[model samples]
Target chain A: MTLAPFEGADALVRRNNISSQGPEGAPAIVFGHGYGSSRQMWRLVAPQFVDDHRVVLFDHVGSGGSDRRAYDRGKYDSLHGYADDLLEICHALGLSEIVYVGHSVGAMIGCLAAIAEPTLFDSLVLVGGSARYINDEGYVGGFEADDVDALLDSLDANYLAWASTMAPVFMGNSDRPELTAELLDSFSKADQAVARQFARVTFLSDLRSDLSSVSTPTLVVQSTNDIVAPVVAGEFLRDSIPGSRLEVLEAEGHYVHVSDPEKLTTTIRSFLG
Target chain B: MNPGVQARDLFDLIPCGLISATTRGVITTVNDTFLAMVEKKREEVVGHHLIEHLTPGSRLYFETGFMPQLKAHGRASEVAFDLCLSSGETLSVFLNAVVDRERDGGTILFAVFDATLRRHYERELLAARRLAERSETRVTILQTATTAFGNAGSEEEVAHALADASRAATDAMAASVYLCDPSGGFSAPSSSGAAKQLVEAALLDALGGRGDPSPTGGLAQSPTTVVYSGSAELSAHFPSAAAALRTARVEALATVPLIDDGALGGILLASFGRPRRLDPPTVDLLESLAQQSVLVLQRIRLRELISYRSLHDPLTGLPNRHSLQRRLDQLLTGTHPNQPTIAVLFIDLDGFKSVNDRFGHLAGDSVLRRIGASLERAVRSGDMVGRLGGDEFLLICEDADEQSAGDLAERLRATVRNTPLEEATGLSVSASVGVSIYRPGTSPEKPTGDALIQLADEAMYQSKRTGKDRATIIRA
Candidate 1:
């Protein structure tokens, strides 16, 4: 498994020379984990791509194994700032014509960076990407404004309840209850205000028109029954973008990458080839 | 657990009343606390209607509204109502009603608690706070009255009013007024009966009216001159009144100055026999009253000069820029939708700089002042003329569209066509005018004070591009 952590470029850069195990000159494929998960999301999927491409996987700023001191709310108010860090990493590694694989908010950041600088990425593979997580007129993303507001209020009202309720879902375990404590520890690492700001920018940004201007070859992979990102939203993205393709996998829950990695990996490899 | 024993023990130990009511409002049960609180017996009230146990006034309230709410909602918590005792005394209680649907189809359970003491204490506390706020308002009004005399219209009126108010405030017997003369003389200008007699008999009699003539006669002198010139020395000059006035057990003696025409005109002297300390703000207010008297006297001198310069501009003897700018800013900030467009043409001379540079500044000054007169005659009566700065002028034309602004710009350009020093030294002089029309929504960029001027300045430079002695109008 390859580790690729996304840290803000303006933040203190940690010089961790984590070794890469893939083709030396192949276009780099950087993976971004979704909310409440870490770089380990790609552990099962990275092995299949490592032999053919330069695979990079990392935790987002304030997440697992990344520099914790680098998270600042003033600088990281929008996903564009996160996209800036993604571009910085590409520039740092001298990787061009790369493919970005992002989940949830990570997918939105990839789309933003691609829109802002079209030539930086050759293609974007968005897994569970939503232009806006909250629904409004002419759009039917899952959550409403009040629902997102309640989620934020609950996150503030009781951190312990928030951790207990949300950690298990991200851990994607019903049979093993012991993984909940480990997931809670990861969620508690960043300041609560910074976490709330990140949630607001992630869930509230409207990127419907942005998909129309995307010149990169795009692949949107969604879960059919995923409670986090719905199947209709995947079709909306496919129909809106000029040449983007959508593929839905028959999965039970939101964390399909963990539940059925073999099927997800095969689908991604076939599409990329 | 034995059911009977547990039930009997629980019934006696419960804190609230537990009563049962029938469909027609008859009381079936009463606990010991409820019986004690209402001073009633279980045997007397158990079979009676619940309305019989309520006070006459409360019985009407409960039957009219309380029973309907409980029957409709099934349960009503913390309902405030009154109950009557067997002795006919009223007790305030909070009742909770629970209606049971099984068995009798509607068996009502009532829980009652005493609430009289808490309600009484809350009412008393609120009343005390209201009384305190009322007293605070009276004190605020009294303080406002004490400061009113300072803002009176005239210096003499302020001086007279302050003396009367101070005497009334401190119950003083008499008051007097003195003013400092420029040659270091303190003369009594005005006085009441007893004060005038004491000043004449004490000082004039002792020193033959020439006792070093009070060195502290200036406006900067302290209120108490006894510190700079000793009280003993003042007593030596006027022993009788000094001794009487000093030993009169007075609460306060205040002196406020009357200033007018850049000199100390007079002072108001107030003395009281009763002991009191004047508040500092009240004393400062008395001083301001004297200053108001002086300002009133000086306003008469300024009124004539003010009226003379009212229509004419003080700088150029032409109509002032204020009236011109008022008319122009009104046209720019238009009130009606279909009002005609207006143009503001900013004119600046091209070669007036070299005239000022070559000739002495006096000759340059005369030429610029002459150009102001020429520009005044060039525009029609409805048009506005203004001197913006050293060599710059502004012409405001009403109801003028782009073509009219172009025509007016040409006339202004031709009017100042002759050179100033060329008539004096045979050189050519010309002026540049920039015209911009005020239109709606043409400049999508937000309009600012500088943007309008810059638009006109750019048009003027376009005329300068046609090589001088020309006018250009820029339409938005």
Candidate 2:
């Protein structure tokens, strides 16, 4: 009868599919993934930090191995709601002066969390992020409202294809059973409604006004070319957020951690130092 | 043709597109079919990144979503994409790609299918699904409204249910219920949402002649429902209202008339922040919500009418004998320092029989109506004036002593004598008035309405015996 099976801040760790490694009590660094991805995205970059820090990784609800039942439409309607969840995860782990790294939508979520509770995060690492994706009168966010609509439609088209064809594709990889299970788990946990709503919230939300209030020391990481969050978006983020620095990496594609993990890890390590 | 040449031809002329690229998605080679599908020459596509060939949306999905799966599983299947063609329009394509990891840095081999028909089918399926969801939501809203409206005990509750239902059904930013007021203008009875002023203005403009609640006509006759797709249409129809809405940034609106018994009773209006056009089913659902409101409103009015009729006289529209009895019981039961005395004036027409005999029954009825009006004016504002059938009438007044009761009786007689019934009927009539007074603690028996009326009736007969058109007073 209880729709929310897990209650209180303590349950957030398990509910968010949280995992931690490296030296305990060391300065913690949490890694958050972007839309349509899981915490596994940071496999290559996060290990480099684990040598010196308590590395934390968790999937947002409705992605990865997180409790699929915990995905509430009302709770995750806006990025602020996701921010609340992020704050809860941080608070549950008793993390303070945390070095937070977030990619894509995760970057905005981190910004919101930092704006709400600046003391909790020492600084923020926003990778390939945009303050806003939809274009405004004077701002160029690289997309129109109609384009976002089409993006949602494309999500639907791909999701329908992903649900059926992905299983057979995974079955072919029996040589790596563990990876096969992980890939299946990642794709299987996705609900179409959640993906669509998440897409809408991610693309349509405008966080230009929130940037100035961010007191946390921030680093905006931009790829040389990213289709989702363009170079201008990272520049805008750097300009709008108070005292934030921008690092344009000589990387390609949206997922900098995936395309060039060495460059992204080195950027964060240097930013932290 | 040689077997090797034929094998090469089969690869180039395959039904689907073929591509070989590095795992990083840079194209290494493409077959003839792939070039033909994208409407690009072999030289143009051979070295380009696959993401560049995709539409922006598809490119985002490919880089973030598709590539990750491809890297992790060594292959990805049935990923949908919209390939940006040479002509600036997109061609829907379904792709299946596998990785050859034995090669340096790995090599990606891809098979692309032109899926224009499949995309068309999928879009239709999605539309169907959306329609089904909307229909289900509409039905649920209607069901909830039906229960809420049916259980509502007052008009305000009904209006509240209506506002909720209309807003839910349309998913509008705001919804308001406006009732037809006595001043002939519409007044907002209930509202739901923050954009109250915007909705009010939209309603005012959309329903021209805002103050004119002309029954069975006006805005109601022109269209039972009004829809403005966006601000422009709203401006075209209602410039001032649209101006207010524009200030609030509201873009769409739909209003349905609440008609009861062929008369416009009110209106249900919903406003949206996005440019919207209500599909046929949605429009029908809105009208159904309006109809529900109308039914509830009619029920309320009917209940009021029935209650009024139960306690009123058919002819004079005054409280009848039954109503007077209830009022007498109320006045006699309570003890108050402000009004300790109760007076009942029992009046009978002294010359009414002659008027009826001479001027017929129609004139008698007219004289009775006029006499009722005069008696009403002669009594104090707090007094209850009612007819006890035939020629008898009673006036129940509180805070009246023997002197005030006698004075009021005299005033009633004089007012009846001064009445203009004689001019119309060629006859003059007057009233023989009797007064009965009761003071608490003075009377041995507690006063009842029937006992008070009997004593007043005896006093009236005494006035009739002494002389017609005279007043008599009795203290009980």
Candidate 3:
């Protein structure tokens, strides 16, 4: 009936799988990984801010080294659980007026965090984020509700099969060979039960209202030839959030962070400046 | 050697695949060794991100683990990734990289090692470990189900316990338990069941859509299991049921037959939120649970049957004299606040000796059976009707007054006269009826049922003395 009171820095780090670099007093740039990869998606882009800004990288509780025991089905059933982690990390580090960079589902998670505590973030960068994955009466999220169900069923197979079939599509950069492999390894890194729950939470979420509520300046990055979040999804995010700019990347796939980190860093930097 | 010869030699040979990439992770140079390993030329290897050649999982490893560590520490070592060779074969490679920083950004140096042999055993071990974990989980689930069945109190509870355990173990959305009733119908599904329409449809489909209500004989010999994945597969077997399941968005169903000593006792139905493949160990454990469930469930049913027979008339399936007395005793102890006078009736056949003496006891027995059925039909909804002995019957009616009791007694006297005995067609049959009403005001204390029955017997004798097929009433 009662939850343990939220612990500060040490507990937040353990719960959210947080890691950081750069000078302590500098402005913070919090980076969130999407479904497939962990904070490594920000490797090529994060180093750009290492000189003057603090680069904070953390995996969602189930994805990386975060304590799996802390994962309660009731708490993590919604995206708010993930967003709360972001806020906790900010408060723990005494970070104010930070930039939140989120990829795919993480974008919506960041938006949720910003809406809850708008003072913590000054700018939001969402790459390939979609408000809803399932197409409603007039939406195109590239999948039906049943398709995601089917995908979860497919994940019921062994890790090898899941890695082979899912990694390519999630990485989406077929022209490059290593990205898919990297994604597969990332998929294998997660606990089986956590991975399955993450898939359900990420694909089944509907967070359109959260976008409009984000008071921070936002940028929506749409990648060309993206299969997961199509051009319309980017447009939806931009249109839903007030005063938000939409940028189309030259890269492709759901993992724009892995495929086109340079473009992301450039666009995000320009928007923040 | 000339400078040109030295440069050409450097490009020709190396111990391992050597490659270099710009700070942006785009490959800008490749040696001959690197080209041969990927089975590509220098031009093909250059000007492309080395990320493209790796498998999806390895791509993830590079981006999430290897690349970040490489950037943070300025060096990454012993990174394993599977690369897609030009021949469509994926090669497992162990990579080590070092960043070389200069005036114009920095270049990344990489060394690749072939790790096919090491990786083969690692993958095999991983699969074996997973199988072991799966079996361990299944063992725990079976232990829980076995314990539940061993301690069950009733047939329905056993079904419920097993369904609850299995659904949680397998992560199923809903579960149902069904037992075959003797009259070619199944009992109402247990509480653990899913939505009515989906379960009904799935039950029908699982049984191959046969109209026969007795599912015991309906099961197929081979496989001993029926599994439907998704609506399409389920539709192929039971179209109507599949339609209902689809409407409920149920993706999978598995029906395991519960056979006790080779006889069908019942069935266990499991519904899933998504299509699933039933693993062998899971299927085996389910079958074991099915067998155990039926054994317990059948035992409960037999116990129930024994209890039923103890208090019910064998021939007519009505309450016997013992059950009727118990009913009256319970009624007296818990009499309602607005209790009406309780009436007890005694009826005796009048015609009897002539037909029995002429056509024999068998003919008289049929008449007795016919009269017994008629007595039951003549009583009110809450009345208790039972056979006392040869040619004698009793009725315990609640809320009956003197006028109503007399009217019921008249109805009882005419019941035998209305239908002639099947064997003795020429003979007419009738009964003498007597009623005793126990009004609470008649006595200060609660009245006993034995006194009322005694009074009713005397009243029946009075009716017999006056004229055979008539009614008499006595108020107590």
Candidate 4:
């Protein structure tokens, strides 16, 4: 059956309500989007998984389908707040043995939630993950503090232009120009200040110590030629976490899941099995 | 070819180079600039092979790829290759091959452009950029260090600030500041790293057993003597120092004296894990920090002395009237708001007038002092006992309701009645005890120190009216 266009999650579900999709007996899978994007990021991937799994998608408090009124700045300022929301959703749905698939900042939230309440999920798939974005005493991730600062300034100057420029690089689809417009729309939908704060929290936060605390089985998927989230960052994540398997896809860039869906799906399926 | 063309016009005419090559690799057409660059003349040899005039390396490269690629492809555009001239110098050149489709494709046109100057300019720009970045980092470190020192207002603040500055300045794994206590002994007061263990070790050694001998001598003796020791004991205990010296890494260490009035208050020891030379400018900064720390220590000491004087009596070292009253009010009124009731006792000495007449006022004063001592011993630590004025004292008992107050008052009366005041002063002395029970919500005005004292005093007068050395209960 074809699904209708989702009404904004922030409007449809009350702050306290839990929303679910797909059949009850199906294998449970939760989809979490990154900073600027919403649950709509999973539009292509969710449908493919739904035939076998109960696909669960919800917006973070301040973003696309969640209750904007319930967004508390102090609580939503860090990854811990998103983790709290994820845990709340798990409790509300009585979901167990679930598989969590997260992208970018969403990957960090999934890791945090898994650490906080390990029994909530059985496995985690982190795409384009980095424990610490900034280089420190021991580790060296390319891009200094100023480089990140420059990126933030670029984002602030003209978010739509920045999104358009980055979308082509992220998806690695220079042939298709429409993807850039889609990304620009997603970025423009959220409040600029809120998105800025979210970006700062996502890119600047150091989570090296947090990776060691995660007990659930994890899969680290990295695109071979991703410039935004480099291969070295993926290697760092793989090395930091215990028992985390790393799968390096020959896919072009950061948004490999969208660009090369068949390869991504095959890898995830094999890992999950 | 255009033989009448002017040298400047022909040489600088196009952005690309111009040349002619024969089937046997002889340069038949050479411009005035190309002839000057190769240091050749037109009459000297138009028949000589171009490979023979060029350097051995260039001859090999031209024969191997350039000639073959041009011959096969008909034209090659923007081929970057190195050219070695007769002067033994190599130049990076962008070579473009031109072939006239009408000319049987036998003769090839070679155009060469000089790129050495551009490449050199780019290299210099990159080097300058790296230098600018390093200079900017140094300035940032200096600014952060200055701000840190300026914000340090107390010994703890200075220690914490120094630790933060060292970490930022050197980018070390950890930084710490150890301070000396009053006894000329140093300990890690504020620190980072496994600071607790290091603090305990330093404290143990300074206290005398022997492990890591004090890095800074007791600054408590003389502030100037508490210099940065660079001692073996320091390197042995502090991992930062060892890391600095072993790796030749830049780790900063600064020791500032916590001085007060030329006497050493303590020493502030700051250390990082990289090898940092104590430069003249850095030493000067540290010295200024030490002086400022002295001022801070003095201000803190003055504040402490003032607070002590306000809370205790100048004469007997007991709490003064102001502090005693504050304590009494807190007990009687229940400052906690959740507690229920409280009690107050007022005692006035009796028959002291006759002692002042017969034995003299000195003996009566002695009797009062003895009573004060006895009263102090009778009360619990939580209870507040204070001299309200001459021959009159007040006691406040906490968490005591009306019934408990009556029992305590009777016990106090009997104890005073049984005391042998006549033996000590050669005059009989007794106390009139009055008890006041606090009633909550009766007086819309909360009970003040004066109000509670007045109630207890009135009850004491009633005790005196009936008989001295007796107790009377007054309910508010």
Q: Which candidate should be chosen as best, given lDDT against the real structure?
A: 2
Encode model 1's per-residue lDDT on A1-273: one tens digit a residue: 333344342232342112256887877787877654566667778777887788866666755456656664433544655776777767656567888888877887788778767898889888887776667688888767665554453334334433444454446634665655655575563445455656565666566755787888899989875545678778888887779999999864455666578988888788888
Superposed model 2: Cα runs more than 4 Å off = A1-7, A10-15, A18-28, A50-56, A65-77, A91-95, A165-190, B1-7, B69-74, B121-133, B144-476
* Overall lDDT per candidate, in order of appearance: 0.62, 0.81, 0.74, 0.62
Per-residue lDDT of A1-273 in model 4, one digit per residue for the tens?
212234443333456333467877677888887765667656667777877887778788776545556755434545666777887776666578889998777888999889878988999999876665666777775446554554443334334433443344445623555665655555444455466556656656666756887899999998875544668888888888889989999975455665577887788889999
Kindly provide the TM-score of model 3 when superposed on the true structure, using C-alpha atoms.
0.60
Runs in model 4 deviating more than 4 A are: A1-18, A68-77, A135-140, A159-190, B1-346, B353-389, B392-409, B417-428, B433-467, B471-476
Instruction: Tell me the deviation in Å of residue A27 in model 1.
Output: 3.0
Docking class of 1: incorrect
lDDT string for model 2 (B220-290, tens) is 56547878876668777676575576545456678788887777778777876545677788889888888
Candidate 3 root-mean-square deviation in Å:
11.5
Per-model TM-score (chain A alone): 0.82, 0.88, 0.85, 0.81
- Looking at model 1, residue B57 earns an lDDT score of 37
Worst 10 residues of 3 chain B by lDDT: B208-217
Could you tell me every candidate's TM-score relative to the true structure?
0.36, 0.61, 0.60, 0.47
Interface RMSD of every candidate?
Answer: 30.0, 4.8, 8.8, 19.2
Q: What would you estimate as the lDDT of candidate 4?
A: 0.62
**CAPRI verdict (incorrect, acceptable, medium, high) for model 3:** incorrect
User: Higher-TM-score candidate among 1 and 3?
Assistant: 3
* Cα displacement (Å) at residue B251, model 1: 74
Clashing pairs in 4: A9-A65, A10-A65, A10-A66, B184-B218, B249-B275, B250-B274, B250-B275, B251-B274, B251-B275, B251-B276
